[model samples]
Target: MKKKLISMLMIAAMAVSVAACGKSTPSETPSETPSETPSETPAEAKDPSEMTIYFLTKILGNQYWAVVEQGAKDAAKELGIKNLVVTGLASEAEVEKQVQQLQDAVAAQADAIVLGPVDSTAMANPVNDAHASGIPIVIVDTMINTENYDAALMTNNVQAGKDAAKEMIRLLEEKGVKKEEVAEVAIQIGSSGSQTIIDRLKGFYEYWDANAPQTWTVLRDDVKVNDGDISKAVGFTQDFLTAYPNLKGVFGPNNGSTVGFVTGLKEANRTDLVMVGFDFSTEIETMIREGKFNVSTVVQKQYLMGYEGVKQAVELAQGKKPATKLIDTGVLIVDLKNIDNDDVQSIIKPGK
Candidate 1:
């Protein structure tokens, strides 16, 4: 009878947790203020040893995430942030697992959390739980749904998408793609529900629709390809080829799917197509050298993102109010003209 009563109490607590997860409205601006100094230490926070920061990202397998992880670790070292840990989702689709990671971090009495939300809507409950536990949460890379967090560091994904699309349009026009022939472009996205992914797709698609020649109609080949899986994405690309014989341009919002799409191009013997993707991956560098595709991309300032995210979380831990929110961590466009130059190489290199 005693055990049954305890189990009932636990079940009731879990129910309350579900209720807290209810929808949170999206914000045009993050709740916390940004700091001017990219200071070496958590500015005016509590004792360093008492501070702990947990960083969570979307996928674990990619080199991109590896860069973020390195940045977080380095910040902890610089700021003496105790018990600092960085973690990522096992797969892109693992939203629930990612939320659970945040909840567990709070249960461990972490002082603060630096978050990279996979699905913004699904993040409210866990983040609220952390807030209720008196643990500060700082969102980075992507925005979360609630205003209860500290600050966010993000890229202007909409602009990045337009940059990529505009470059592709220029390439097509340069190649003298006649005004009558439509450019059958396809976008193979990494995750369907993520706000970052959605924003990227929206920006690119909107630009392509408005700027491309009147004859060029956007290919509605809406394929959800895994950013982590080389093989599955390659297979999806294979299917796309068989279906769209007139395919012209291809785009991917994340690095893994970009590499996978490139593999598909090589397999189908369609290396002549004008393909543009996000991220300056190793494959992109090699292809640019070989003149394979007029390939170019928008590079995110991920290292700075890593460094600043942890730094801010620590500040929040110390009860220091940040001066800024929506820290637009910057992006740059890479193309054939400058792909081999020092600036481009610097962007592609991580943790520099």
Candidate 2:
């Protein structure tokens, strides 16, 4: 009888526990079944075809910018973007024209803008204004001083500068340049106002100061600004060659400047100096393959810049933030040895 009573008591306790679990407090019970879960319906995707995107390059006609244009156009086509307007100034120093273009884009109520800024500081106010107006600004190749941009796709210029410095050293060493040898290097830049140029020059100087021999020097005080004029760059190169007899290396940090150095060196009948440059052109390609002097160039993925710039702009227009504010397009140091490699050739002759 005692065993049966205990067993009955245990059964009663379990029944009470089950009854308690089955009941719900008023707050714990949902008032009613939701009409639908939040995840059941999502916002509709925006149509890129209805939007107007503007592609503003730093300058037109140069191969570097040409490749960038090609990339942007290709992306626009692939995305089925209906209205893509591509425009740029005749020169990189046309800051006022670019500024006007930005204002005009705003006036036209451009859905998004892909820009390669001519001057970092000069473009800041306009860029900020454009952003404040609710338009997305996607920068390519260069950067503006203000952080108001939606996305910036560019090469890591400072690192490229350091890489150029290292290549310059290697080329010099190949031609029997000794650490103790007294030689000077001259630098030519596209424009003084370009943050791209400024950063590159900074990287080069920083690396050289830390790694170069005491006797070797960069002409910091004599750095030349070509203002994106190849003729001016050539003239400056000639001046450097004439003034600095001990000049052993030349660094040109842009497409026009690089061509200027190559041309000036050939015109001067100089085959003893090492030349390090940026960007890839037929002139640079041929010189690297056939030129007597040591020549190399730091080539950037300019085409990728254009493609990604437009893509990011479209994303922003659709109320999406980019994965990151800045994108490093990357660089390749091409010399004679690697010039013939398939990968190197692809970069230097992207579409060809």
Q: How large is the C-alpha RMSD of every model relative to the true structure?
A: 16.6, 5.6
User: What is the C-alpha lDDT profile of model 1 across 1-352, one tens digit per residue?
Assistant: 9999999999999999888765443343334324533332455547756776788877785767777777788888888766887778777778889988988898888888888888777887778878888887888777777887878888888888888889888877776678789667777877766677778878888998888877776665566557467677788788778887777777878877788787788777686677777776677667767776767777787777888889888777776778987789888877768876786666567545
Query: What range of 10 consecutive residues in model 2 has the weakest lDDT sum?
Result: 33-42
* Candidate 2 residue lDDT tens string, 35-128: 2333222354467898899998877888789999999998999999999998898887899999999999999999899999999999999999
230: Cα error in model 1, Å: 2.6
True-structure lDDT of candidate 2: 0.89
Off by over 4 Å in 1: 1-44, 350-352
In model 1, the worst 10-residue window by lDDT is: 24-33
Q: How many steric clashes does model 1 contain? A: 5
TM-scores, each model vs. reference: 0.83, 0.87
Alpha-carbon local distance difference test for all models:
0.76, 0.89
Candidate 1 residue 154 C-alpha distance from true site, Å: 1.4
How big is the positional error of residue 203 in model 2, measured in Å on the Cα after superposition? Answer: 0.7
